[model samples]
Target: MTRPGVSAFSVLGVCALIGLAGCFGPPAPAPTGTAAPTSTASPTASATSTASPTAPSSPSVAPTATATVPPPSSAPADPTPTGEPTFTGFPEQVARLTVYYVAIGDNGVSGPMIGCGDSLVATSTAPVRFTDQVGPSIGALLANKSRDVGLSGLVNALYQSDLTYLGGELAGSTITIYLSGQFMLGGVCDVPRAKAQLEYTAMAASGATSAEVFVNGRPIDEVLSLK
Candidate 1:
Protein backbone atom coordinates (compact mmCIF):
# COMPACT_ATOMS: atom_id res chain seq x y z
CA MET A 1 0.00 0.00 0.00
CA THR A 2 1.16 3.48 -0.83
CA ARG A 3 1.27 6.11 1.96
CA PRO A 4 -0.28 9.50 1.69
CA GLY A 5 1.51 11.85 -0.83
CA VAL A 6 3.48 8.84 -2.04
CA SER A 7 3.23 8.58 -5.81
CA ALA A 8 2.94 5.23 -7.62
CA PHE A 9 6.15 6.17 -9.46
CA SER A 10 7.86 6.56 -6.09
CA VAL A 11 6.62 3.11 -5.05
CA LEU A 12 7.82 1.71 -8.35
CA GLY A 13 11.14 3.49 -7.80
CA VAL A 14 11.41 1.83 -4.33
CA CYS A 15 10.70 -1.55 -5.87
CA ALA A 16 13.37 -0.89 -8.55
CA LEU A 17 15.88 0.03 -5.84
CA ILE A 18 15.11 -3.23 -3.98
CA GLY A 19 15.54 -5.22 -7.24
CA LEU A 20 18.83 -3.38 -7.95
CA ALA A 21 20.08 -4.12 -4.43
CA GLY A 22 19.41 -7.80 -4.90
CA CYS A 23 21.19 -7.81 -8.25
CA PHE A 24 24.26 -6.00 -6.84
CA GLY A 25 24.35 -8.05 -3.62
CA PRO A 26 25.53 -11.60 -3.12
CA PRO A 27 23.68 -14.43 -4.89
CA ALA A 28 20.64 -16.14 -3.31
CA PRO A 29 21.25 -18.80 -0.57
CA ALA A 30 19.18 -21.29 -2.65
CA PRO A 31 22.35 -22.02 -4.62
CA THR A 32 23.98 -23.32 -1.37
CA GLY A 33 21.26 -25.98 -1.05
CA THR A 34 21.91 -26.83 -4.70
CA ALA A 35 25.68 -27.11 -4.24
CA ALA A 36 25.95 -30.74 -5.35
CA PRO A 37 24.14 -31.91 -2.17
CA THR A 38 27.70 -31.83 -0.81
CA SER A 39 27.56 -32.22 2.94
CA THR A 40 26.87 -35.97 3.19
CA ALA A 41 26.08 -37.26 -0.29
CA SER A 42 28.99 -35.73 -2.24
CA PRO A 43 31.75 -36.98 0.09
CA THR A 44 30.07 -40.41 0.34
CA ALA A 45 29.65 -40.64 -3.41
CA SER A 46 33.24 -39.56 -3.98
CA ALA A 47 34.47 -41.97 -1.31
CA THR A 48 32.53 -44.83 -2.87
CA SER A 49 33.77 -43.93 -6.36
CA THR A 50 37.38 -43.80 -5.20
CA ALA A 51 37.09 -46.94 -3.06
CA SER A 52 35.12 -48.91 -5.65
CA PRO A 53 37.52 -48.31 -8.50
CA THR A 54 40.59 -48.96 -6.38
CA ALA A 55 39.17 -52.02 -4.64
CA PRO A 56 38.24 -53.73 -7.90
CA SER A 57 41.29 -52.48 -9.81
CA SER A 58 43.73 -53.67 -7.17
CA PRO A 59 42.13 -57.12 -6.98
CA SER A 60 42.05 -57.43 -10.75
CA VAL A 61 45.76 -56.67 -10.98
CA ALA A 62 46.57 -58.92 -8.03
CA PRO A 63 44.71 -61.89 -9.53
CA THR A 64 46.55 -61.60 -12.84
CA ALA A 65 49.87 -61.32 -11.04
CA THR A 66 49.02 -64.12 -8.62
CA ALA A 67 47.67 -66.34 -11.37
CA THR A 68 50.94 -66.12 -13.25
CA VAL A 69 53.00 -66.38 -10.05
CA PRO A 70 51.23 -69.53 -8.79
CA PRO A 71 52.29 -71.55 -11.85
CA PRO A 72 55.94 -71.23 -10.79
CA SER A 73 55.25 -71.42 -7.04
CA SER A 74 52.86 -74.39 -7.28
CA ALA A 75 55.22 -76.08 -9.73
CA PRO A 76 57.80 -76.40 -6.97
CA ALA A 77 55.06 -77.08 -4.41
CA ASP A 78 54.82 -80.57 -5.99
CA PRO A 79 58.02 -80.42 -8.08
CA THR A 80 58.29 -84.17 -8.50
CA PRO A 81 56.07 -86.96 -7.25
CA THR A 82 58.39 -87.09 -4.21
CA GLY A 83 56.06 -89.28 -2.21
CA GLU A 84 57.08 -92.94 -2.39
CA PRO A 85 54.61 -95.06 -4.28
CA THR A 86 52.37 -97.05 -1.90
CA PHE A 87 53.16 -100.55 -3.19
CA THR A 88 55.12 -100.60 -6.43
CA GLY A 89 54.41 -104.16 -7.44
CA PHE A 90 51.18 -106.10 -7.08
CA PRO A 91 50.88 -109.22 -4.92
CA GLU A 92 51.59 -112.50 -6.67
CA GLN A 93 50.48 -115.70 -4.96
CA VAL A 94 53.05 -118.53 -5.38
CA ALA A 95 51.28 -121.04 -3.15
CA ARG A 96 47.64 -121.76 -2.45
CA LEU A 97 46.35 -120.17 0.78
CA THR A 98 43.21 -118.85 2.44
CA VAL A 99 43.07 -115.04 2.48
CA TYR A 100 40.83 -113.35 5.04
CA TYR A 101 38.84 -110.09 4.67
CA VAL A 102 36.69 -108.26 7.17
CA ALA A 103 33.06 -109.26 7.07
CA ILE A 104 30.85 -106.20 6.68
CA GLY A 105 27.05 -106.02 6.88
CA ASP A 106 25.43 -109.47 6.51
CA ASN A 107 26.33 -110.22 2.94
CA GLY A 108 28.97 -112.95 3.33
CA VAL A 109 29.93 -112.80 6.97
CA SER A 110 30.77 -116.33 8.03
CA GLY A 111 31.12 -115.80 11.76
CA PRO A 112 32.56 -113.56 14.49
CA MET A 113 36.33 -112.94 14.30
CA ILE A 114 38.44 -115.63 15.96
CA GLY A 115 40.51 -115.00 19.12
CA CYS A 116 40.94 -111.40 20.42
CA GLY A 117 39.22 -109.09 17.93
CA ASP A 118 35.75 -108.30 19.32
CA SER A 119 34.34 -105.92 16.72
CA LEU A 120 34.99 -107.73 13.49
CA VAL A 121 33.59 -110.76 11.64
CA ALA A 122 35.64 -112.51 8.98
CA THR A 123 35.48 -115.12 6.20
CA SER A 124 37.98 -116.84 3.98
CA THR A 125 37.17 -119.32 1.22
CA ALA A 126 38.83 -117.52 -1.69
CA PRO A 127 41.70 -119.89 -2.42
CA VAL A 128 44.41 -117.53 -3.65
CA ARG A 129 48.13 -118.15 -4.30
CA PHE A 130 51.10 -116.64 -2.38
CA THR A 131 54.76 -115.85 -3.05
CA ASP A 132 57.58 -117.20 -0.86
CA GLN A 133 58.99 -113.77 0.17
CA VAL A 134 55.66 -112.07 1.02
CA GLY A 135 52.56 -114.21 0.95
CA PRO A 136 50.58 -113.25 -2.14
CA SER A 137 47.56 -114.31 -0.12
CA ILE A 138 47.92 -110.96 1.63
CA GLY A 139 48.20 -109.38 -1.79
CA ALA A 140 44.87 -110.92 -2.70
CA LEU A 141 43.66 -109.35 0.54
CA LEU A 142 45.37 -106.03 -0.33
CA ALA A 143 44.28 -105.94 -3.94
CA ASN A 144 43.06 -102.60 -5.26
CA LYS A 145 39.90 -104.37 -6.28
CA SER A 146 38.54 -106.55 -3.52
CA ARG A 147 37.31 -110.14 -3.83
CA ASP A 148 34.55 -111.37 -6.15
CA VAL A 149 30.73 -111.07 -5.99
CA GLY A 150 30.25 -113.38 -3.00
CA LEU A 151 33.40 -111.86 -1.47
CA SER A 152 32.46 -108.30 -2.49
CA GLY A 153 30.62 -107.98 0.80
CA LEU A 154 33.94 -108.49 2.58
CA VAL A 155 35.80 -105.40 3.76
CA ASN A 156 39.54 -105.83 3.46
CA ALA A 157 40.88 -102.89 5.44
CA LEU A 158 44.24 -103.45 3.74
CA TYR A 159 42.60 -103.75 0.32
CA GLN A 160 43.62 -100.30 -0.86
CA SER A 161 47.33 -101.22 -1.10
CA ASP A 162 47.75 -98.82 1.82
CA LEU A 163 49.46 -101.58 3.74
CA THR A 164 52.46 -103.42 2.35
CA TYR A 165 53.17 -106.84 3.77
CA LEU A 166 56.91 -106.67 4.44
CA GLY A 167 57.19 -110.44 5.10
CA GLY A 168 56.55 -113.09 7.73
CA GLU A 169 58.47 -115.47 10.00
CA LEU A 170 57.68 -119.06 10.74
CA ALA A 171 59.11 -120.21 14.08
CA GLY A 172 57.90 -123.62 15.28
CA SER A 173 54.09 -123.49 15.59
CA THR A 174 53.58 -119.70 15.66
CA ILE A 175 53.77 -117.48 12.55
CA THR A 176 54.80 -113.80 12.73
CA ILE A 177 53.88 -111.46 9.90
CA TYR A 178 55.42 -108.02 9.26
CA LEU A 179 53.62 -105.30 7.30
CA SER A 180 54.38 -101.64 6.58
CA GLY A 181 52.67 -98.84 4.64
CA GLN A 182 50.40 -95.87 5.18
CA PHE A 183 47.34 -97.28 6.92
CA MET A 184 44.10 -95.65 5.92
CA LEU A 185 40.91 -96.81 7.57
CA GLY A 186 37.25 -96.73 6.79
CA GLY A 187 36.48 -96.25 10.45
CA VAL A 188 37.50 -97.51 13.90
CA CYS A 189 36.19 -101.04 13.49
CA ASP A 190 38.54 -101.81 10.64
CA VAL A 191 41.39 -102.32 13.12
CA PRO A 192 40.14 -105.62 14.51
CA ARG A 193 39.04 -106.68 11.06
CA ALA A 194 42.46 -105.96 9.61
CA LYS A 195 44.23 -107.71 12.48
CA ALA A 196 41.96 -110.70 12.16
CA GLN A 197 42.52 -110.82 8.43
CA LEU A 198 46.30 -110.75 8.88
CA GLU A 199 46.48 -113.33 11.64
CA TYR A 200 44.07 -115.74 10.03
CA THR A 201 45.74 -115.44 6.65
CA ALA A 202 49.18 -115.91 8.19
CA MET A 203 47.96 -118.93 10.09
CA ALA A 204 46.36 -120.41 6.99
CA ALA A 205 49.39 -119.71 4.81
CA SER A 206 51.91 -121.22 7.27
CA GLY A 207 49.63 -123.95 8.66
CA ALA A 208 50.54 -122.64 12.07
CA THR A 209 48.69 -123.06 15.36
CA SER A 210 48.78 -119.27 16.08
CA ALA A 211 49.87 -116.06 14.41
CA GLU A 212 51.36 -112.74 15.51
CA VAL A 213 51.18 -109.63 13.29
CA PHE A 214 53.56 -106.65 13.14
CA VAL A 215 53.50 -103.39 11.23
CA ASN A 216 56.69 -101.49 10.35
CA GLY A 217 58.46 -103.94 12.70
CA ARG A 218 56.21 -102.93 15.60
CA PRO A 219 53.26 -104.94 16.88
CA ILE A 220 49.94 -104.20 15.25
CA ASP A 221 49.02 -102.28 18.43
CA GLU A 222 50.57 -99.03 17.24
CA VAL A 223 48.83 -99.01 13.87
CA LEU A 224 45.50 -100.05 15.33
CA SER A 225 45.74 -97.49 18.15
CA LEU A 226 46.63 -94.65 15.78
CA LYS A 227 43.65 -95.43 13.62
Candidate 2:
Protein backbone atom coordinates (compact mmCIF):
# COMPACT_ATOMS: atom_id res chain seq x y z
CA MET A 1 0.00 0.00 0.00
CA THR A 2 2.97 2.46 0.67
CA ARG A 3 4.33 1.75 -2.81
CA PRO A 4 1.04 2.81 -4.32
CA GLY A 5 1.58 6.58 -3.01
CA VAL A 6 5.20 6.87 -4.19
CA SER A 7 4.12 8.92 -7.28
CA ALA A 8 2.89 11.67 -4.96
CA PHE A 9 6.34 11.81 -3.34
CA SER A 10 7.76 13.34 -6.65
CA VAL A 11 5.66 16.43 -6.06
CA LEU A 12 7.38 16.98 -2.66
CA GLY A 13 10.93 16.77 -4.19
CA VAL A 14 13.18 19.98 -3.53
CA CYS A 15 13.81 22.32 -6.54
CA ALA A 16 17.47 22.97 -5.41
CA LEU A 17 18.24 19.27 -5.26
CA ILE A 18 16.97 18.72 -8.82
CA GLY A 19 18.95 20.09 -11.85
CA LEU A 20 15.78 21.50 -13.56
CA ALA A 21 16.10 25.11 -12.39
CA GLY A 22 14.08 26.24 -15.49
CA CYS A 23 11.14 24.42 -14.06
CA PHE A 24 10.76 26.95 -11.25
CA GLY A 25 12.96 29.59 -12.95
CA PRO A 26 16.37 29.95 -11.23
CA PRO A 27 16.04 28.88 -7.60
CA ALA A 28 15.86 31.93 -5.32
CA PRO A 29 19.24 32.33 -3.60
CA ALA A 30 19.24 30.94 -0.09
CA PRO A 31 18.54 33.75 2.44
CA THR A 32 21.85 34.09 4.28
CA GLY A 33 19.70 35.80 6.99
CA THR A 34 20.75 39.31 5.83
CA ALA A 35 22.90 40.35 8.83
CA ALA A 36 20.14 42.54 10.26
CA PRO A 37 21.16 45.38 7.78
CA THR A 38 24.21 46.40 9.92
CA SER A 39 22.48 49.39 11.57
CA THR A 40 23.37 52.29 9.14
CA ALA A 41 25.62 54.52 11.32
CA SER A 42 25.60 58.24 10.33
CA PRO A 43 28.97 60.17 10.18
CA THR A 44 30.19 61.49 13.60
CA ALA A 45 30.72 65.05 12.13
CA SER A 46 26.99 65.33 11.27
CA ALA A 47 26.00 65.11 15.03
CA THR A 48 29.13 66.69 16.69
CA SER A 49 29.78 69.68 14.35
CA THR A 50 26.63 71.78 13.65
CA ALA A 51 28.22 74.30 11.20
CA SER A 52 30.04 73.07 8.11
CA PRO A 53 33.81 73.95 7.84
CA THR A 54 33.10 75.77 4.51
CA ALA A 55 30.32 77.94 6.02
CA PRO A 56 31.10 81.74 6.17
CA SER A 57 31.82 83.26 9.64
CA SER A 58 30.04 86.22 11.18
CA PRO A 59 30.86 89.54 9.36
CA SER A 60 32.97 92.24 11.13
CA VAL A 61 30.60 95.01 9.98
CA ALA A 62 27.44 95.88 11.93
CA PRO A 63 24.39 93.99 10.90
CA THR A 64 22.19 97.10 10.33
CA ALA A 65 23.62 100.43 8.93
CA THR A 66 21.90 103.88 8.86
CA ALA A 67 22.76 107.30 7.28
CA THR A 68 22.41 110.72 8.99
CA VAL A 69 21.16 113.73 6.99
CA PRO A 70 22.00 117.34 8.00
CA PRO A 71 19.19 119.80 8.62
CA PRO A 72 18.78 122.71 6.11
CA SER A 73 19.96 126.20 7.22
CA SER A 74 17.44 129.08 7.35
CA ALA A 75 19.83 132.02 6.74
CA PRO A 76 22.06 132.44 3.66
CA ALA A 77 25.86 132.65 4.04
CA ASP A 78 27.61 136.00 3.35
CA PRO A 79 30.19 135.81 0.53
CA THR A 80 32.35 138.79 1.64
CA PRO A 81 33.65 139.90 5.06
CA THR A 82 32.40 143.19 6.54
CA GLY A 83 35.43 144.85 8.19
CA GLU A 84 39.00 145.66 7.03
CA PRO A 85 41.83 143.54 8.37
CA THR A 86 43.86 145.23 11.13
CA PHE A 87 47.51 144.92 12.21
CA THR A 88 48.29 146.77 15.42
CA GLY A 89 51.69 148.31 16.34
CA PHE A 90 53.32 147.15 13.09
CA PRO A 91 55.53 149.32 10.85
CA GLU A 92 53.48 148.39 7.77
CA GLN A 93 50.22 149.54 9.36
CA VAL A 94 48.89 152.59 7.52
CA ALA A 95 48.40 156.13 8.93
CA ARG A 96 47.00 158.81 6.60
CA LEU A 97 48.83 162.17 6.22
CA THR A 98 49.27 165.08 3.79
CA VAL A 99 52.67 165.31 2.06
CA TYR A 100 54.31 167.50 -0.63
CA TYR A 101 56.09 166.65 -3.91
CA VAL A 102 58.20 168.72 -6.33
CA ALA A 103 56.62 170.91 -9.01
CA ILE A 104 57.14 169.80 -12.64
CA GLY A 105 57.32 173.26 -14.38
CA ASP A 106 60.58 174.13 -12.61
CA ASN A 107 62.90 172.38 -15.12
CA GLY A 108 65.32 172.02 -12.14
CA VAL A 109 67.00 175.41 -12.87
CA SER A 110 63.76 177.29 -12.16
CA GLY A 111 64.55 180.08 -9.65
CA PRO A 112 65.17 178.59 -6.17
CA MET A 113 61.98 176.85 -4.92
CA ILE A 114 59.96 178.65 -2.25
CA GLY A 115 57.33 177.32 0.18
CA CYS A 116 56.97 173.58 -0.76
CA GLY A 117 58.72 173.93 -4.10
CA ASP A 118 60.14 176.71 -6.34
CA SER A 119 56.70 176.39 -7.96
CA LEU A 120 53.88 175.33 -5.60
CA VAL A 121 52.02 173.08 -8.03
CA ALA A 122 50.00 170.51 -6.03
CA THR A 123 48.20 167.30 -7.05
CA SER A 124 46.89 164.05 -5.50
CA THR A 125 48.86 161.02 -4.51
CA ALA A 126 48.48 157.47 -3.18
CA PRO A 127 51.14 158.47 -0.64
CA VAL A 128 52.89 156.18 1.81
CA ARG A 129 52.00 155.87 5.53
CA PHE A 130 54.15 156.71 8.54
CA THR A 131 54.13 156.79 12.34
CA ASP A 132 55.69 160.05 13.53
CA GLN A 133 54.88 163.57 12.35
CA VAL A 134 58.17 164.84 10.88
CA GLY A 135 60.46 161.82 10.65
CA PRO A 136 57.88 159.48 9.20
CA SER A 137 56.57 162.27 7.01
CA ILE A 138 60.03 162.68 5.52
CA GLY A 139 60.33 158.92 5.37
CA ALA A 140 57.06 158.83 3.46
CA LEU A 141 58.46 161.48 1.18
CA LEU A 142 61.55 159.38 0.45
CA ALA A 143 59.32 156.34 0.01
CA ASN A 144 57.01 158.09 -2.44
CA LYS A 145 56.90 155.69 -5.45
CA SER A 146 54.03 156.88 -7.70
CA ARG A 147 54.45 159.68 -10.25
CA ASP A 148 51.49 161.96 -10.97
CA VAL A 149 50.95 162.09 -14.76
CA GLY A 150 47.78 164.16 -14.30
CA LEU A 151 47.29 167.94 -14.71
CA SER A 152 48.56 168.37 -11.12
CA GLY A 153 52.14 168.42 -12.53
CA LEU A 154 53.78 167.17 -9.33
CA VAL A 155 57.04 165.14 -9.16
CA ASN A 156 59.31 163.49 -6.60
CA ALA A 157 63.00 164.16 -5.79
CA LEU A 158 65.65 161.74 -4.49
CA TYR A 159 63.11 158.92 -4.51
CA GLN A 160 64.32 155.26 -4.88
CA SER A 161 67.72 156.36 -3.49
CA ASP A 162 69.45 154.76 -0.55
CA LEU A 163 69.30 158.15 1.26
CA THR A 164 67.65 157.25 4.59
CA TYR A 165 66.54 159.69 7.28
CA LEU A 166 68.41 158.91 10.52
CA GLY A 167 66.49 161.30 12.81
CA GLY A 168 65.71 164.96 13.34
CA GLU A 169 65.68 167.46 16.21
CA LEU A 170 63.06 170.21 16.34
CA ALA A 171 63.91 173.18 18.65
CA GLY A 172 62.79 176.78 18.49
CA SER A 173 61.38 176.76 14.93
CA THR A 174 64.65 175.17 13.68
CA ILE A 175 65.21 171.52 12.75
CA THR A 176 68.62 169.77 12.76
CA ILE A 177 68.49 166.53 10.70
CA TYR A 178 70.86 163.50 10.49
CA LEU A 179 70.99 161.25 7.44
CA SER A 180 73.12 158.25 6.35
CA GLY A 181 73.26 156.02 3.25
CA GLN A 182 73.63 156.57 -0.50
CA PHE A 183 73.07 160.20 -1.61
CA MET A 184 72.11 160.14 -5.26
CA LEU A 185 69.94 162.31 -7.52
CA GLY A 186 67.92 162.08 -10.72
CA GLY A 187 70.22 164.63 -12.41
CA VAL A 188 70.80 168.37 -13.02
CA CYS A 189 67.01 168.75 -13.27
CA ASP A 190 66.56 167.36 -9.73
CA VAL A 191 69.38 169.55 -8.31
CA PRO A 192 67.36 172.54 -7.07
CA ARG A 193 64.25 170.40 -6.50
CA ALA A 194 66.27 168.24 -4.10
CA LYS A 195 67.26 171.18 -1.87
CA ALA A 196 63.76 172.67 -1.89
CA GLN A 197 61.79 169.43 -1.37
CA LEU A 198 63.79 168.03 1.56
CA GLU A 199 64.35 171.35 3.28
CA TYR A 200 60.78 172.62 2.98
CA THR A 201 59.21 169.22 3.76
CA ALA A 202 61.13 169.08 7.03
CA MET A 203 60.14 172.63 7.80
CA ALA A 204 56.47 172.02 7.03
CA ALA A 205 56.29 168.79 9.04
CA SER A 206 58.22 170.08 12.11
CA GLY A 207 56.95 173.70 11.95
CA ALA A 208 60.65 174.63 11.76
CA THR A 209 61.53 177.95 10.13
CA SER A 210 64.94 176.55 9.15
CA ALA A 211 66.27 173.00 8.43
CA GLU A 212 69.98 172.01 8.78
CA VAL A 213 70.56 168.66 7.06
CA PHE A 214 73.77 166.66 7.60
CA VAL A 215 74.66 163.60 5.51
CA ASN A 216 77.01 160.97 7.04
CA GLY A 217 78.76 163.40 9.42
CA ARG A 218 79.23 166.67 7.46
CA PRO A 219 76.42 169.18 6.83
CA ILE A 220 74.75 168.93 3.39
CA ASP A 221 75.52 172.67 2.85
CA GLU A 222 79.25 171.82 3.16
CA VAL A 223 79.35 168.43 1.40
CA LEU A 224 76.55 168.44 -1.19
CA SER A 225 74.73 171.74 -1.61
CA LEU A 226 72.53 170.95 -4.62
CA LYS A 227 72.05 174.77 -4.48
Going through the candidates in order, what is the number of backbone clashes in each?
A: 5, 1
Please, what are the lDDT tens digits per residue for candidate 1 over residues 30-106?
75655665557668777777686444534534345555563444355445666877854545654444666555654
Global lDDT of each model?
0.65, 0.64
Candidate 2, 1-227: lDDT as tens digits: 46665565576576445756667676778787764443335456565565545556764775443345556677567556659776463344454444566766664444345533356333333554655567876776677655553445666666655678898887898988888875567666566566666777787767788988888888876655543
State in Å the error of residue 49, model 1. 99
TM-score of 2: 0.46
